[model samples]
Target: MFKKRSLWISILVVTLIIACSTSSSSVPKLRDKHHQPFSSESIWNMPIGADAQYSGAGLGQAKRFSPEINYYIVTQETDPQVPWYFPQNWGVGRCELGGRQLGKIHVRADLIVPDATENKTPNNAAAFLAPDGETLIQLNPLTRCEKGGPVFGHPTPREENIYGMGITGGQGGSGLSSIGGTIRLGELLPSAPPIPHVLKLLVYAHQYLYREPPGYRWPAVRSDAYAYKDDSPLRYGGSNPKLVMGALLAIPPEMREDDLGLQTLPGKKLFHALQDYGGYIVDDTAWDNYAIALESGAETEFELTYGYSFGKNSGPFYEDINQLFRALSIVDNNTPETLGGGGTPRQPLAPPIGN
Candidate 1:
């Protein structure tokens, strides 16, 4: 009787597991909305579109491009530009104005101002996504008046939509949100899905940063320019007109990932992503290295759980990534109309924006 009962219980558990998986499988998933938060039509979410054009101008230049571009360390104590995610409890706070206590706004619940403020730095950046699935809240430099009281920071004056143009939210000289375009948890892991969105890129802006008169592209309203060659001070500065802000850099579709000989799992993942969706040059690294934005707190979680460090010299991981960046070229036609450079899309267009 004991043997029979145990076998029956095991069968019941297995049955429950199968039933759960089958039921949730058909749920209408709007592609990458889980890892990358935004509408399907947002530039970051959509893959390369039809008749794509390439900006061979920058990679064609000497100083701005590098084979050994540095990887961003989100686990670092400062300047990672990560965010603390809060659950769906919309709490109204008095100090939502960075400790003034007069302004009130609905923020992610239980946002202990002190805890958020303690991790401050020059780019003391953090992000909050309201449950509305549309608005993105910026906590550029969160501050508090009390231990766990209402909190606030230098949030943006312009309302930011998660599904809107991912420009101008955080402290970056570029008006991009600290949260958008960042690699979220599990994205680089071995068992993860292929990244369906553009990854964010930061490059050393010394002589490489360039802009046209009036500055930057449409999606990018303005920029912290190194110079505009048309009237630049530094001789030979801004040599690459294609290095303008909002440049969509990617591995040319002709370069197949299989031929790249990438060794690390993460590197292979990155190669496919760059090939399919590519990454956007969203901000300046402020130094002579390139960095990709990863969500805050995600690196620690990945390391502890998977025992892999996202830092430099992680064997073939960095090597694989460097190879991809070295081959990155700009999409000169990635305008609002030709979103991903009008051409046969590298990947299927994300499901059209809907309910």
Candidate 2:
């Protein structure tokens, strides 16, 4: 009798498990807002920072924002010049006056080519070779704002640019690669949340610190694993979208969970800042660690309002966010090597030395 009862209970439990998985499989697509079967490649399956390491060995000093956190202030400035790869009017609507917030970032712009109608050579036509030497990826008509088609999922090849749901801005793990500027207190009436909403991302042209992009192959890197003359990683600095994505994935899931992670007041606030407010990635190398964009008279406004509330470190914001991420292992974007296990990074084995 006892054996029969156990057998029946086991069968019922298996049935319930199958039912639950089948029912919750459909997720809404951002493009049509219609429910679609979750594909094997969905971004949901990909880990955060699915691209590259979060921290690099060459970024130099780390800033401690709290007792438990330390960060690299990658870039902070007002009115910096945009990178050459970015499209004109890239942030026209997205980074407009009222839209400064987290996940807000700049991106590489489409190149303008010479129209056959005109006699002269096109201004900024550049050649981009694919990872396979034989295929040349066309950059003449590369798009900054053009919406992409549905992304099958994350871990999409760097070669095929298509990302999730076809929405250009939201799906690409590229956006999460870097953080951007937002309204500061006493600077043109701050926004409601006081910062841009989380997940909005941006990237401007700059250099990366490493000589070689460690994680994976890049379009411009040579067969010898060195950068081409026109795209030397060392001379131009560096930015690896993959590295940033990988770092995001390394963040503890518990940190995101209200019930399991982040229970303390500061921990909760910091988690919200990272998960919602957003954090910056050292996508490209720059003169100073922080590079904030200034246009639309923002630079002048910041200068004029200096004595007021918006000066550095005066607002409620924490200057160095990398500190909050210290709970995870420090990922060295500059190093191609991996530790802890395969491509996946494991929890830090020991407390940070010299802490």
Number of the top candidate by lDDT? 1
lDDT of 2 by residue, 157-196 (tens): 2222222211111112132211112222222322222222
Clashing pairs in 1: 50-342, 50-343, 51-342, 51-343, 52-341, 52-342, 52-343, 168-175, 168-176
TM-score winner: 1
Candidate 2 residues lying further than 4 Å off, grouped into runs, are: 1-41, 44-209, 213-249, 252-282, 290-316, 320-322, 325-355
Error of 2 at 30 (Å): 9.2
- Give Cα-based local distance difference scores for all models: 0.59, 0.27
lDDT string, candidate 1, 163-263, tens digits: 66655566444666666667787776667778777877766555565534443565665676443444534312456767766678888878877777788
